[model samples]
Target: MFDYFIAPFSDYTFMSRALWGCLVLSLSATPIGVFLTLRKMSLSGDAMAHAILPGAAVGFLVSGLSIFAMTIGGIVAGCIVALLSGMVARHSRAEEDSSLAAFYLLSLAVGVLIISSKGSNVDLLHVLFGSTLALNNEALLLLSGIASITLLVLAIIYRALVLECVDPAFFKSVSRFGAVAHYLFLLLVVLNLVAGFHALGTLMSVGLMILPAAISRFWSNRLGVIISLSFVFAAISCYLGLLLSYHYEFATSPAIVLVLGLFYIASIILVKQCGSFLMKRASLAKLSIEQPIQNPSSIHKGQSNV
Candidate 1:
């Protein structure tokens, strides 16, 4: 039981790299996911995932098996899809979701068509879901670069992201950088999705991005609490999933994603009931409450008789 679980930890270069690669990605993606879900941009994650197919396929066609260059190409392509769909929706009264869905579906179809024309269906296996055991230095670098970019973008736009997530109209008035901030977040999502696809597969990457954050919300209402909990869960899922996959001989990316989804569901039921407030502080605060003052009453009956 402990053998496959702990075996990868003992010795293995690629496995160690894979561990770091996913942990970093989970750190960025999990927090962004909470924003996406809160903003009802959940579908946007799916749209971005589907939209990457074509770029990845095209990259494979041109670069053979260079996952680095190919994934960059895919990330760029997905960003294009995000920007264009947004532009179309904003320029006209047409809905962003409607436009996004169309673009995503089209991209998915085009990707399949391109992959079909280039070669056999063998690439589809790796494309749809990744093979983590096969991770190379190139894959590690790509994931790291995307994670770094995501964190930077978030830092610059953290307040705006929060405002937009809670109230877009208020965000527009208060933040001078609201529009830029919005697109930037979308851009980060595309990049993160592209990077995470290798570890979560095309279909499951969105879940990996969204689930852990959603799970973390059950335990706290503070934005900081949710974000911190999300990052921890993401890291845990990534490490444990990799360890479990190696031991069980299961697929790595999906296994990691599966563990995340499990945590999401588990938190939904369990964390909702945990209620972990600081007891000492709460007790002290309760003891310091002041009573409300009462207005003086007049003896109207006696005054009238006098």
Candidate 2:
């Protein structure tokens, strides 16, 4: 039983690297995801994830699975889509989300076409689904560097970002940084998604970002608590998902994401039920305490009347 849990990671360097890669990703990405959820940009995050695909596919076509090349390509594609969507929202009648959806759908179709036409089925699968258990030194370094940069930038802009979410108009009036903060936040989303794509693929990367944030809402109302719990939940899902993948030979990325999905479902039911139970108990106790006092007063009045 001990070996079952320990052997896979201890025996294999790849497993260890994968674990580190995912945990590092969770630290930075989960906080961004929390803010994204708070700002009601969950759908935008998903859209940006898809938007990175064409750039990555282009890199694969040019360099044949080079991590550096693909990372650059993905980042470029993601930022471009983000800027375009924002611009469309400002200049046109279409809403930001609607513009983003249109761009990402087109990007997805284009990415698929490019990969299918120029690359192999294996390449397509790798770009679409990721290579979690097969991470190399380059992938690990990329993930680490992105995580560091993400944390640093977020720390610097945390207050402004929070203000942007809580009161955009006040944020705009008080500081000239509202648009800057919004764009910067979107860039962070793209960067994290690019890093996540190396581990979970373009399709599953948003799951790592969005699912944990979704689950944390059930457990916490405070931003700090939600962010902390999001990271913890993401880490646990990654650990268990890796174990299950090793044991059952399931696809690692989807396995990790599906574990998170299960956690989400469980949180919703368990937290709601617990809250309801406590409320019911409190209500009953209040009624019971009041009942005796009211009864004695009524009896005293009845005796005086007799």
Candidate 3:
């Protein structure tokens, strides 16, 4: 069992890159994911992952296998889609969800169409499903660079982001920092989303983005604890997924994603039980206190009921 788990590590280069990518991806995504889930923008993460396609297609058409070109295209497309959806939601009198659904689905179709029309030389399938084991040096660098930038930006904006998240009205009334921070946050997310596409593909990337964070929410009421736990959970899922995929000859990205999904389900059940237990304990304590007050007459009469 240990051998199987350690097998991937036997290849110093291949597994090293994968593990590094996974760590960066988990670190960048988990805290951001916590915010996204709390903001009800979980679907937006999914949507942005898919929306990166058109940009990727265009990049591949021009630059072929250049990860730099591909990343640029993905970030551009993601930002446009996010901004457009926001604009449509604000101006068209349309529901936010409806607008998001339309833009996200349309972007995906358009990406496929562009890829189809341009040429068939590329394996566009991998973009949708990811090829984690095949990640080259360039991909590792991209993941590293993006992760560093995202973390730095997130650190700078954490307080403001928290403020906006908790008190948007108060923030809006006082400073423009919230507005700037919001867009910057989205930009970092899109950048990371592009990197994640290489590691987990669009379909599974959303799970990594939101699932661990969602599960972490159950164990922590404090933002810092939830964020930390989320990162830990994501890291474990990545390693487990890689080990399982290698052992079972499974696709790495999907395997990792499925592990995260399993973790999320387990968390749901466990968290609910924990919550119920806390609530029950509180109720029992309240009842214990109230009993003495309600039965003052019994106390005065020396009537003790067990």
Candidate 4:
């Protein structure tokens, strides 16, 4: 167990860095993910993930993979797309989901075109799938900083967000800051996606943001517990996925996402089974209660007939 799990981090600096980076990412991204799931904006998180690509690609073209450049570019691009989607949904006949889908598809194509036009396939792969094992100090700092900002902002907007999820009409009526919280939450989503872009790439970053939240829903109903469980799920997935990647030479980003996928599948299966069992027990109990009452009625009827 030590050699398999503990040795990798101890023997390799990169492994340790990767683990730390992923843990920090889970800190901020998972809670936001819970809120995303709550708001039924899970797919919106995915759309914004792809939405950051063109900006990152542009930054790559300009700075040749400088973390700061790509990050800034991705954040700018993601924010623009998110804001545009929101505006179109409010101002036009088009709904938010359809508009977001259109923008993300276009953004993805434009990003791939830009990257392929200027850089090689390797650069494109890095932008799409991420380079998790190659994280340096700069990348670590960026992840940490983003996590800090995300957590602080989430704390500030916590109440509005809860109200927004629970009752949007009431939230709007009660607080003028509803729009502010909504937009700020969107901004945080973009920031985290940008941060995730550095480690998991545009394609896979949202996995870290969304999957654990999805899994946590199976286990808990309370918001606080769900958020806590999501972080734990994400952290465990990262550690195990990194180990798999280190030992088997799998792509780190996909491995991590795949592990999360496994957890999600397991959660679904377990929850379904538990629900079925509970329903069966309830039905049995109901039948037993009704059977005794019917038996007593039959006895009373027979006595009356006699």
Candidate 5:
């Protein structure tokens, strides 16, 4: 039994590396996802994930599978989209979502065109889908480093980020950290998505950030608890997904994402039903206690008769 569960990772070096990469990513990216979900910018994160593709594609064209080149390219592309979308939303009459959608769609087309024109179909597949099973020391190191930087930045800016999400106008009034906080958080989002793209591909990277956060929302409303739960959910999904991929020969990234989807569905049903049950029980108890109090004369008459 132990070997059945543990041998795949223990016996295979690649499996272990894959586990480490995903676990680190889960720890760092899940928190950013939580913030994104809270700020109601989940779709924005999805858009930004696509936006990084052209930059990464340009990097690929220049360096040909160089991790650092692609990463830098992705970051530049993502930040450009984010800033442009924000600018358009502010300066023009277009909504933020519409502008982001337009930019990401354009970026995706441009990225695919560049890759297809300069490189092979395989290269295009790599950029769009990623190479999770082929993760090496370099890719792992890049993921770990990004995770470390993300955690540090998030720790330093935690309060400000929360304030900006909760009450942007209040944060602006109290200090000049409003725009700073917003941009810093967006930078963190881009960093996380780029890191995720290395493992999950541009098409699916946002799933790692968004699904665990969405799952946690079903279970808890407290920020700290929700954050912790999101990490736990993501880690569990990674572990299970890797195991499933190993055993079934399924695509690793999609397996991991599909497992997260399962968690989300289960959380919605179980957590919501549990909450409803508890609320009903509490209401029943409260009604029982108040019934006699509201009809004191009837209670006294029954007592005297008895």
Candidate 6:
């Protein structure tokens, strides 16, 4: 057990770094994910994930994979796309989801083209899938910094965020910070996506952000518990995924996401089964009560006939 689970981190520097990076990521990303899920913006997280690609790709082209360059470029691109999507949805005929979908698709294509033009298939793959095992001091610092900034900002905006999720119209009516919270939340999403891009790539980063939240919904309904559970789920997935990758030589990012996917599937199955069981019990109880009442009525009717 120790060799299988503990040895990897203890024996290998890269494994330890990967684990630390993933934990830090889960710290910030999972809560944002919970809020996104609450707001019914889960797909928006995915859209923004792809939307960051062009920026990261541009950074790659300019700086040849410098983490800072790609990160800045990705943040800038993600913010622009997010702002444009919101603006278009508000000011134009297209709805927010439609507009977001359109922008993400275009951003994805443009990003792929830019990366392919300047870099090899390997580089493109790195930008899409991430370099989990190759994280160094710079990448670690970036992840930590993003997580810290995200948590602090989230704390400051906690009330407004909750209000926005619970009742956007009401929040806007009562609080001047409604729009500020929305935009700031979007910024946080972009920031986390950019941070995840460094480790999980544009395609897979949102997995870290969204999947655990999805799983947590199966276990709890309270917002605080759900957020806490999500972080745990994400952390466990990261450990198991990294272990699988280390043992089987599977791609790290996909392995992590695959574990989360398995958890989601299991949660769905378990919830359905429990629900079915509860319904069956309720039905049986109802039938028993009804049967007794019917017997008493039949006895009364027969007595009257006699």
Which ranges of candidate 5 are over 4 A from the true structure? 296-306
Each model's lDDT: 0.81, 0.94, 0.85, 0.95, 0.93, 0.95
Q: Global CA lDDT of candidate 1, please?
A: 0.81
Cα lDDT for residue 287, candidate 5: 88
Expressed as tens digits, the lDDT of each residue in 189-255 for candidate 5 is 9999999999989998899999999999988889999999999999999999999999999988999
Candidate 2: tens digits of C-alpha lDDT, residues 43-72: 999999999999998898899899988999
Q: What range of 10 consecutive residues in model 3 has the weakest lDDT sum? A: 118-127
TM-score per candidate, chains pooled: 0.84, 0.95, 0.91, 0.93, 0.95, 0.92
Per residue, candidate 3 scores C-alpha lDDT tens digits across 1-306 of 657677568766677678788888899888888989887888888888888888987887898757888789998999999999899999999987788888889989988887777766346677777778778988988888888898999999999999998899999999889999999988977887898988887667777889888888878889999999999999999999988877788888888888888988888898889889999999999988997899878776776653
Worst 10 residues of 4 by lDDT: 291-300
Off by over 4 Å in 6: 282-306
Clashing pairs in 2: none
Ranking according to TM-score, highest score first:
2, 5, 4, 6, 3, 1
Off by over 4 Å in 2: 293-295, 298-306
Q: Which candidate ranks first by lDDT, i.e. highest? A: 6
RMSD after CA superposition, every candidate: 6.8, 2.5, 2.4, 3.0, 1.8, 2.9
What would the TM-score be for candidate 6 when compared with the true structure? 0.92
In candidate 3, stretches whose alpha carbon ends up further than 4 angstroms from where it belongs are: 118-122, 279-306
For candidate 1, which ten residues in a row score worst on lDDT?
Answer: 290-299
lDDT of 4 by residue, 1-306 (tens): 899999999999999999999999999999999999999999999999999999998899899989999999999999999989988999999999999999999999999999999999999999999988889999999999999999999999999989988998998898899989999999999999999988888899999999999999999999999999999999999999999999999999999999999999999999999999999999999987897676888767778999
Better of 4 and 5 by TM-score: 5
Candidate 3 lDDT: 0.85
**Against the true structure, candidate 5 has what lDDT?**
0.93
lDDT of 4: 0.95
Task: Tell me which of candidates 2 and 5 scores higher on lDDT.
Answer: 2
lDDT of 2 at 41: 92
